[model samples]
Target: MRRYPEIGKFTLKVYYEKDPEVRADIQKSIAKYADFKQNVKQLNFDSSQFVPGIDIEMMYNDMYWASEGYIWEKIQDEKYDVDMMERDFLKMVDFWKSIYLRKEGEHDEGN
Candidate 1:
């Protein structure tokens, strides 16, 4: 809650791949979502509320890695997983994104 630090300031310290192409893409995302990410990070919510009792920073970083792991996955598509079980901010974000997409689809159908 109010006692917790902002999520962005949590310093997930996610690392970018050394490959130029991958690094570039990640950078682009980082830039495009800088404000969004920063704002999310700044929210004074307890990381524990969503994520498990594990190290919050590790879990947050894991979410970022998993979400952006398309390169290692040979995905050539979207990225998104990781080793943590407890729900985290990214999980909530993904959940919300799903809702938004679902609603959008519904609206399209309605139209």
Candidate 2:
């Protein structure tokens, strides 16, 4: 079996509505968990790993757009709503973190 590189960084894309308000929410939520600005060095999408019901294409597009500037800039941009975007972003971050943690080491039965 091939070993994947340790997930040193991650980027999350939320594919819900294009509305700025909703996007903001998602961004805020993500910030609460993952430091989108600090933790995520780059944002890209893999269709094979994307969650069901989420539009991976749209998320990828948003990430590409946000990549132009730092996390704060992306959140402040009128293109998306920080609060709503945070929610989805955070969830995605959490999921990614979980996978990263799992791959790093197996949980000890007694810890």
TM-score of each: 0.31, 0.25
Candidate 2: list runs displaced more than 4 Å. 1-79, 103-111
Candidate 1 structure quality by residue, lDDT tens digits, 15-99:
3356786678677777744344565667666543442234544545555565555324522322222223224545757874453
Q: Best-fitting candidate, measured by lDDT?
A: 2
**Model 2 TM-score?**
0.25
Off by over 4 Å in 1: 1-41, 48-53, 71-111
Root-mean-square deviation of candidate 2: 16.4
The backbone clash count of each candidate, in order, is: 4, 25
On residues 1-43, what C-alpha lDDT tens digit does candidate 2 reach at each position?
0132122111223423357988888777655334434533454
lDDT of each: 0.45, 0.47
